[model samples]
Target: MSEPKRMGRMGRRPGHGPGGGMMPGEKAKNFKGTVRKLIQYMGKYKIAILAVLTFAVASTAFGIAGPKILGQATTELFNGLVAKVSGTGEIDFGKIGRILLFLICVYAFSALCSFVQGWIMTGVTQKVCFRFREDISSKINRMPMKYFESRTVGEVLSRITNDVDTLGQGLNQSVTQLITSVATLIGILIMMLSISPVMTLIALVILPLSGILIGIVVKFSQKYFVAQQKYLGEINGQVEETFSGHNIVKAFNKEEDMLKEFHGTNDMLFQSAWKSQFLSGMMQPIMGFVGNLGYVAVAVAGGMLVVRGSIEVGEIQSFIQYVRQFTQPITQVAQVSNMLQSTAAAAERVFEFLGEEEEDLTAEHPVKLENMEGRVSFEHVQFGYRPDQVIIHDFNCQVKPGQTVAIVGPTGAGKTTMVKLLMRFYDVNQGSIQVDGHDLRDFNRSELRENFGMVLQDTWLFKGTIMENIRYGRLDATDEEVVAAAKAAHAHRFISTLPGGYEMELNEDASNVSQGQKQLLTIARAILADNPILILDEATSSVDTRTEERIQRAMNNLMKGRTSFVIAHRLSTIKDADVILVMKDGDIIEQGSHQELLAQHGFYAELYNSQFEAA
Candidate 1:
């Protein structure tokens, strides 16, 4: 079997490198820039973010005061016990009760603040995510067709779904955690310094060392995170391809091959994922160890101070709690680096798509199509899909108001490309196409496209009822008009036989109906559009002879007085055309009536004879 189509290089345009593998040492480039832009997206929600921050600070402050206040109760109980042991005083149960009640209130207030902060931030995160998705959706429409041609559907979809999700989760969880952690760190530090500056110094010294270690781990883990995201996109592309083309894979007995390829991609993703997680996982344990050492040092120093009566037992107790709280936030701060790395990687992909060059839709006083007569002309049209290599060079063609132009050629002979240019899907590199003597570039693209109707060999139908799918051609078309269009295209008979007729719902893939039925539905859609110019790209190629005859008759009626361009593979279909232009290697090698071409006995005659011989 032919080698499987190369799944292009991960994270780059296809066909550039030797083996389509990622370059070595490829980290998430320009991470800071990506992060800056991501922050800008959040800027719109500043008021909500400020409220979250206010609640977070309030919660952390209350929590920080609880440990110290609880220490006050400990001191009170200690003094009462000592006094009772000497038989000089009784325990003050009332004072102790009051302290306990106040502690309970402090903790309760902290909990409420935390909850409020979470609620506000969650809404903000979702809104930010919604805007990202909205912008990406709009960006997709603004992009030129070339962008979609280069990228897989899964790749683009992953940006909207997976990448956006990653950004949302990171912003929701990490941003709030970072804020709380920093706030807690500061509060703890102040409490520790007030109790014992020496102990605070001991705790502070360990932090720089922990920071150095965290930096080292993060340096290694970030590359893996970038690789993980890249491989995720690749795996998504693989799954999309395999599932969409499952029938072809089974017909060719390529299941094992597909599985092997999937496993290879899966393994790559697994390796990067675990490595990133493993390195990040190391942070907590390593910080815990350093924290234990700091704890021991502070404990030893505080004990000596207590024995010397330099500090109270209650202060030492509060200091130890502050030490633990401080270390935890440092650990959280370190983990935020990892979180930020993943966010940057995902955001970079999304921003890259949004930054793609869009087609220039701007026109100054653009010409509009009015009273269109369906006249089209190509004047020395030079064009190519790529600029370095021109495909259709110095081509010329013209047609009057009422004519059927048949384009026939072998595969890869630029028949489709020529029509695509006429539609302005791709502008010609070095020539002009005119509709009604007005340059195509002079008119608005939407207005230009509205005047032409197309039905291709590959029929596209969305997940909707048959009537709705036909109505897609003209959104405002009435139900009666849709039915009339379907009847005109000869689609009404078979559609009526279905259980719900025009109201039957199609699944996402539109697989409920047969291929011919789908083509007829598309034809009905074009019929409803009722444009002055029609494009039929192998409109009946996939149907059986009887269905082909019916479709051909419908097309003939549809093409009655309009200018139509028919690209056909079957020689028998276009025998009665007003003109047949035979194409070869992007140039029209022969042009005349079919009979005239047969009389010439050249490339056109040989192509016609081959079809007869094959039959």
Candidate 2:
């Protein structure tokens, strides 16, 4: 059977729409640090970035020059009309036509520059996102099992998908907008000042007021934006859990409870989302209002100067257009703070994951297993998932080469923990587990793991053909070898009966096959591996008695001349084991042959007899 998927904690939730922001309960504490690191990532594409900047500057310059040049046409038209009214000269239609053509060429050139900048920036954003995802994928392998144990698949997936997407969007849109806004603001200020310093002073009065207003709104909105992203991650995690475990939920009749929990998170997300959107949405209108006020003041003041013969009407027109252009960038600047807040929040989550403690892979003079005899020993081993509380304490065991040892116990006896420790999934807190006189820690982890084969109770099968799944045990195994292993494990009969035979494809979750069939495939995989050591955890518990008998016969053949550890809930299966170790509460309570333990009438005997009595 497929493994039961684990669930994670549900915190604040985000909106239902894709890419909607929801606030997290905790904000990213190191916002500046994340931003600095993001900047450093962008530094890798310096030449492309420089080209984008150059194009943006050119685009803005051409755009900014349009209104001022159009003002000159207005001035010429006004002068020509006055001359015609005075009967002193004819209106200069040729000059006006030339000015109109120049304006069209300038605007077209500006559009081309903007398009090139956007195209280049898109490439930059995609390349950077690619690098970020690559690093994250590599980092996942280096991380310890404890990291995955503490987090959920959904939470980790959210970081890789949603957070990386947020960062990419911020780079693509926010970065370029920031550059354009600042450049436009500065260039317009210079144009306005050059036209008339008095009108420029009037426009300057509104700048501080606008800044203060934006500051207040952005200050309140930043927290919500941060919360929005956090909630988004939580919502994603909850969705993943609920969907993966939908069958369990239905079996347990938890529909109402699940709905209630989802609604609670959804409501929290709504509250955060609306507030963030509302505040950010206010910037444009507020800036527009302030901008219009500045426009009126500049127009009225410029009109008085025009009447006093200090400035021309065309210059006033240009100054008013400059004032409008100036306020747009201010509005964009205000909106960018919200975008930056979201980016920083997403970056912090990703960076926090990337910065998690990786397993210590360092070994001084690492040993390699050559001609492995599979003589295993545990001497004074101690361990716990957490450091403050130890579970397995001072455990000791020894197994000779080619011996079949069975470990029997009730649930939570740390049976699986022992297997994990032997495979170096978790390092022991005290003493050592050794293979052939060398400490397991001293051996190179990959080489050490290669010596053991595992057939877990929860069989894992990826989306592939049956033949391909069997070949996973030995990547370079031939098609004939895979079929031979399947025959040895008694999986070939069932696989041949399927419509496509060995070439039958499994679904993503391998749900197309029955539970017993999946188990048989896993057995076939293990048989193909041909490792010196094997760990079988309830390998046949999911199959029928007849199938179990077949599997036991196959396992006996596979276990010949190999050290094997069998973990079983069914006491009858391990009756012929060389040694049967009975455990409880993380420590072994008894060890002997099956007949010897039965004679003692202790834990093993009681456990063994209970199965029979229940049957």
Candidate 3:
């Protein structure tokens, strides 16, 4: 959420990404620009948005105008009744019929305006929702590794679904009501002042009081809404945790602990939501009650004025309708402020995501990678995940094209960091990584990544058929090509025996499949990708001895004529490497062929002896 990083080196490094730790609530800066940026999303559908506004205004004018005509007709009907009862008695039929017709027409026009307003509101809402959903999804696609690292799955999903939903509902319901409220207030105020200045003044004396009360409530309500959003995010994070780690929870018999965590978050959300709603819900009825008091005052004053022949009976009736009209705006203004804040909060989150920084990859005039031969080198590289601890310090190594290199060491010895550097997930703090003769910084990020295939110690096979999972390796690959890769990875025979063969469905994370099979399927994916460089980070460490042989065979098939990096704790995988490097605390402690290092009886020799002796 910080500025799209200073590629020019202008400020302190952001903590989450590169330079340093970010400000605690650094995300709020992008929120600061939300309304402005959100307005930008409306550009594609501005015509629809404007249409909604136009219909809203027109509807209010017609709706408020109808009530005024109805008020006049009611006054005439009353006066006629009085004359008839006083024995001057003939009610005029023409006046009665004409007023009846006018009343019918007024109701008819109001219905028509309501329909038009509803249609435009629907269009506007759809357009806004579409824009928000599409933009958020696209941003997800463009976002980098660190964004996912920093936020939980639940928090991200909540913004995509819950926050956008809140914005949509609030916008659709409130906009039309706000327009009607404002227009009605204006029209009604004109009629009331025309009736009599003194009565109008008296009716409006309580109007400012309503505003003052609403403002006070509004100020406090925003704070509660902010708390509500925070708690909602917490609840989302917990729910995601429960689902993702459900197996672990049950395995450890920690279901009760998980339930307690969920309930705590749920209770927090409930309290926050209740407080916000309680204040917002007070607006309409409270304002209506005060407006009713003003109505009583107006009726008493107008009755005396009419008796004094200072105000007409019909005019006094019209003034009562105007007082009702004025009350509505006061109520609406209160409600609208809550919706506005809800919108602002949602916009803030959305804009913050849109503004988040990604690792700087050259976009214009990018270095093109063509037919990469995959000679990789690290030149005095210094890198660290934290400021206090440097992982890779002044490390240097090189692998020629079509060579197989193995990195072995204790845990946290920067074996995996080398592969990450080759992949450019994180840039080095000092020194350089180069492929062939070109510095990594010069390569287009996607172009550079496309050259390598990786198989981690922990295999990643999503819930899908084996064919679909392999097809993920290269999206444009043919079905026949997928089958060929599966055969190469030695996964085809077992897949053929399954009920649906390569079409078999997997359990969540492929839990139904053996860990070795999952690892092979991921290897099949890598084989299908057909890149010039391969990285195996403890790839066969999870498999059984027989499974490791099968994987070593598939890995051998994939590594032929390609540059490969193997980070293996099992000394067997490294024994056949072109060169083996033993690393410790992010620096190379020994480097040689396997036999050459064993003769020296150094760190690699000790590690090899310990494992082989254990066997």
Candidate 4:
């Protein structure tokens, strides 16, 4: 929930250890970090925690002590009544009635505490759940695009929903309940010894063997449950991949291929889940066997004592009740163990996600730019998605302030990588990127990103009003500013025709709207941002000629006096660029204005010719 950790490079690069290589997942066993993160949630609700513990302890005491009192009262009454029947004394029902009243009071108090436990824990758990989800959302937002590219949306959703909700019983209730149950067991054991030590020992002999069995089940279950959670994540990934690309599946007639992948994931999940559940399922029968054996011991030993006149009948009854109390809590404790492990596995994943590297926030203090000129330069910058396969090696380029620089390149020419580095989504492996003569790293990630606006090929809009989507560019934008930005992006006319004008609610991903409209909305966002620098990544690829021309006019108005970097396969869009860099295979092969490149008739000329020829 606290501001995410800033990018730290003092030690090794992230996702690595002291070995200077990728650390395997199981070897480090960093589950403690996960446990600590969860337990920290308890801090905010200290008063609720205290209240739950108090009620649980009080309830346990009544549950344990009340039975013993009733037992003594019965023993005394039966012995006294027997004497009276033999004409030795008179019966005392009044004393017995008081014992009955005491038992009723104890039951009432225990029930009330149980109610309090449920009520307080409900509030505590719901609050923790909300905080946990909110912190995760914030964490994900700050993570670089690398994280999302590496993980599917469904796998992420599992941690937020399934994994998080598992804590409801295990996290909030188990702590208090486990403590209370253990205390109750101890109290019962001590009281049983009072009636007859030999009997108590005989009754308890089965527990050690039971503990061994429980331990074995737990040890194996932890391994299997961890596997189960992992497989679930895999299955979630498969589902996300299939559904998100359902259109592609149908278009390419890949339903069978998709189904095969789904079946593989489904089978793995089943095996993992069944193995984990089978181990846990064994606990109940084993617990029942141990408990029933205790019953046999108590009956045999208590009968012996009675025959020897060592204890009265009622004392024997009290011991039986106490035996059930002690052993039944064991069953509850075992169940708690099972749930806690599952919850911990989920917590590990959730905390692991929250610990991802975030955008640098150290430069909370920034010098405001009074007059901005958008000059951008990359000097000997090297970068990659993976450590081994470098995408951009020793790349260099320069743009004068307020100049339009267009980059034309084949696929994987590092055209997109160049823009990504310029935006500082991923830091370069070598050299420096500078803006206005200052190193980009020195400006802080947030302050640096805020200086530029970007429009990508694919557009994303939330399920909200159209006005809300455009206003995302500047959260504090006025209604008039939003309308003006929309007009500049040539979006206002289409928006006005909608039933609700700018207030129309869009579907998920804005799928209901035309692709061009979505692009316009994204452009409106950029227009509203009005930053001194802009990067357009194939902004016109998804639009028609008419729409592109309209957006081009809007972009020209937006780019005046601001540096703009445009990456396009369509050469027409870059014709007016002051400088065009033609890249191939991670290297810049030519650099000049459009006419200058065409005159030389090299890589840029070929690339330009190919695009129009294909069309």
Candidate 5:
């Protein structure tokens, strides 16, 4: 089946804290390094980012001018009141109206600038996210199978979904916030200094204290953020595994065990999340307290200066506003610092996935076989999933074109591993595998796989119609051809008996159809593929005896001239004129015709007799 479009919602959990855009405790292993790589990744959008920064600065600067200009109006009104009370002059209503109008225009201009920057930043962020998803999708196809085998589906999927989304949101918000916060800090400081130097110094003194507190909070909260992110993936994996195998879980009566495991992971996630969020949440209050302290100092110092006739009354009011503005940016910067840490953490995961070792599919000079005879050979082949543990040791085989080779063995006999090697999913650790005298490595992987058709034990039917699923085997095949193939695999009758015939839509897991029907569809798909080499691993194991008989005849017709490798446990079905390789452990102990191997009565006879006896 196709991969789930949007998997579990691990990020959005119950009891999540406010300002949930960032997980503060999640710090990157290499913050600066990750940032540098992210910067490089976004290099193509440099001009757009630059424009966003410029407009953000302009917006903040224009906004910063508002309070100072409003102070002028306050000063004029105060002077007019004084003059009016003395009966020397009346209030300058026209001048005051002009100042107020000017303040409105300044604020309006600031808002316009903010909108432009936000629009541009959003576009840039979306473009980067799109590119990340595209690159990751392409990367998955070229990566070795072992990489996926070593990790959970959710862990890998998290790179594309949660991590990319987090990076995009953090980039959009933090970049603008950082620029505006810094600009506001600088602009407010200049305005405050212009009004009164003593008050400005008093206000600036609180910055060091705020910085120290933020640093302390960040240091203590970082590990928890890391833990939270880790557990989030674990929780997602656990959920995916449990749900996918829910039938097995119930069959085994392990609901309590599953709940216990889930609760354990959920508790870890909750602990880390609460700790990190709580620590980061402390920043706003601590900065507010420091800011209020700065406000008190600025007010006292400004009042003393005003009494000494050093600063105007309106100027003190503006300085107090500036002190408030100053502290706000500091708080914003602290919040942005946490956002940056989260951004770094998410970006690091994306980069790590991108940097994984991809399979080199391209051969220096690829060999193209115009007429593939399907003459396959394995010479002293040796392989293992890992280098230290050799599973298939000293395998030697040769097959002429149009021969059917039945591989019979107990489980863990390296039967499937042989198929993997032949398909070049993993290269052999020693010796070589060849087709028509050319080493598998000499041909490009895509071209090599193009010549083979596979009907796996686990059938994969994506979310589509039965016709479309069968058509997946040969994308260019017509409807008539698909029908013919289905008939050949004895899938046409059952499909016609279904409600929608070939037009029925399969769900994500294709669970509407029976396991046997799914197997028939996959066989139909392989038949439609019509490749020169066929690999059928338990192709008829799912059907009943009657259906199996029909499918066996269809399979015989399908494998007539093609080189087929049939891996099965049902020895009764494969007692034909073909070579049989009997294996045990990891070695092929017997190789001959069915009768010859039975006459020898080695592992093959033992396995063959045991199956009928059990039945």
Candidate 6:
């Protein structure tokens, strides 16, 4: 239960590799499939999405009409000036004023439409994010223990946090922008063509050139972007590992080696990042150059048309404005393409997690054995964490009600594995584990677990008061009961001496307290649970001899009428057990009272002798 070992089993981010980092805009392997899945997931929000799309189109259409409408004002002003110059008519100031006011109203209405769509889209995105998080949380509880053991904690958490968040933000932006970009492109094209199809054709020449340039930049930069993301994760992992194990590195005098490793990772990250940024950066300027060429060509073509009376002078101004507006949507489309990839990647991860194999907690004809007396039996149980590697073989054991069974073995002797099997954390590959003559699987997993209490070597305490932490064992337990359990576990005395007594709040990880204190809190939790069956795995390992003695006395009282399985490394703790089972490799080598096992002079005797010899 060392810190690093605990972290390896359940670390928060586990470095910035697959499980950590936002990793925005990453390419998805199955882009089309993922997008299809996302659309299916979002099907319930179709109405809201449709509203957003409608409003987005309306906003773009209204925005597109601004330049053309203003062009009308320009035409009116030009006509008035020509008339005044020719001394035929006075300038129509009132008409020009009316036209300007109408243009303002149109722009204002467009802004309003944009705001309404954004608000609606944001709500939809957040709702989708909320559902994703809820589903992931629920999915975790239904998942098999093996699934968690086979992956890092961060990897699972990434689906709920990073992936969902990325999906939400990308969804909010990409959907609206895509709709607006396409709408704007279409609306602008029609307006340009309406004014002068010849000049519109001239303006359209920028598309292929811009497309080729953008395609080349994206093609070259994509690999670098991927590499940059990879090396960034690697470098972050190095930094996290180094800092978390700084003391170990210093103790081993490996500072130089750590630094060298960091330098190597950092250099690679730098190379990829700069190259990707430089190549992607070239996109805007290149597009702008091509656009400027198109603008110049359109300007020349419009002027020729204007001189020949093919189009009006004000029409030339409107066409130039349309040309400028045209390139923006194309740029947005390119940008949205990258965003969609990111959205697809994030959505894919989330969908993958939600689609994982879940444990079948539902038993069709569940055995309802109430008032369980805790008679347990492991009949020819065989199991392994992996299918190909069987660890426990023919692990047969039986314990009557209200008996203390002590399992003693070396580190890799399948001691903990048996406890896990009994609890149904994992099912036996061969044979069955039964409780009160009923197969473990016959009962619902939750109902089966409700009859047992567990206190492990590795203590876990959330950020809460000592009373709350203890009361976690039984949510409805009163304050007096919590305090009583704490006293039984010998944690009350230390708790009372603290600043807030039983009301003292523990920090995250509970590092504010000593290891022994944390262990005592967990023991208190188990005691408060008051279950019919108890499993204690090296529960007293963290405490000193004096505190251990006190807790042992309390444990003796607590186990008075309950069936208890005590898995211990320290042989002295289980001397008074009703039966001592000594396991070696996988099977039990000997089973008897402590005195009887000592008389056998076998593996258990050797193990007991070695501990005293070392002491």
- Candidates' lDDT values, in order? 0.84, 0.85, 0.77, 0.79, 0.86, 0.88
Q: Is candidate 4 or candidate 6 better by lDDT?
A: 6
List ranges where model 2 is wrong by over 4 Å: 1-27, 207-286
Give the residue spans of candidate 6 off by over 4 A: 1-22
RMSD of 4: 6.3
Q: What stretches of model 3 exceed 4 Å from their correct place?
A: 1-33, 40-47, 87-89, 92-97, 103-118, 140-144, 208-285, 312-318, 363-370, 385-390, 461-464, 506-515, 612-615
Candidate 1 clash figure, as a count:
0
Task: Report the candidate with higher TM-score, 5 versus 6.
Answer: 6
Worst-scoring 10-residue span by lDDT in model 3: 1-10
Q: After superposition, how far is residue 539 of candidate 2 from its true place, in Å?
A: 1.8
For candidate 2, lDDT tens digit of each residue in 1-615?
112122323332333223333243333578889888887877989899999999999999999999898888888888898899999997798998999899999999999999999999999999988998998998987788778776545567777887888878878988789888888988898899889999999999999998899889989998887777777667776776788789999999999999998888888888999999999899878888899899899989999998898987788898899988887887787668668787788878778878888875756899876789989998998999999988888788899999999998989888999988998879999999999999998987777888999998877888899999899899889999999999999999999999899999998777799989999999999999999999999999889999999999999999999999999998889998998888888788999999999999999988888888956
Cα displacement (Å) at residue 476, model 3: 3.5
Worst 10 residues of 1 by lDDT: 1-10
lDDT of 6 by residue, 353-397 (tens): 899998878689998876889999989989888888888888898
Candidate 6 steric clashes? 0
Candidate no. 5 TM-score: 0.90
Model 1: runs farther than 4 Å from truth? Answer: 1-28, 205-290
Q: Look at candidate 5 and tell me the lDDT of residue 158.
A: 68
- Model 1: per-residue Cα lDDT at residue 498: 96
- Clash count of each predicted structure: 0, 6, 6, 0, 2, 0
lDDT of 5 by residue, 331-373 (tens): 7887898789989998998999899999879899999998799
Sort the candidates on lDDT, descending order: 6, 5, 2, 1, 4, 3
Specify the highest-TM-score model's number.
Answer: 6
Please list all clashing residue pairs in model 5, or write none if there are none: 25-225, 26-225
Q: If scored against the real structure, what TM-score would every candidate get?
A: 0.88, 0.88, 0.83, 0.82, 0.90, 0.95
How much is 41 displaced in model 6, in angstroms?
Answer: 1.8
Name the top lDDT candidate.
6
Cα error, residue 557 of model 2, in Å, equals 1.6
**509: Cα error in model 2, Å:** 1.5
Question: What are the root-mean-square deviations of the candidates from the true structure over C-alphas?
Answer: 5.1, 3.8, 6.4, 6.3, 4.1, 2.5
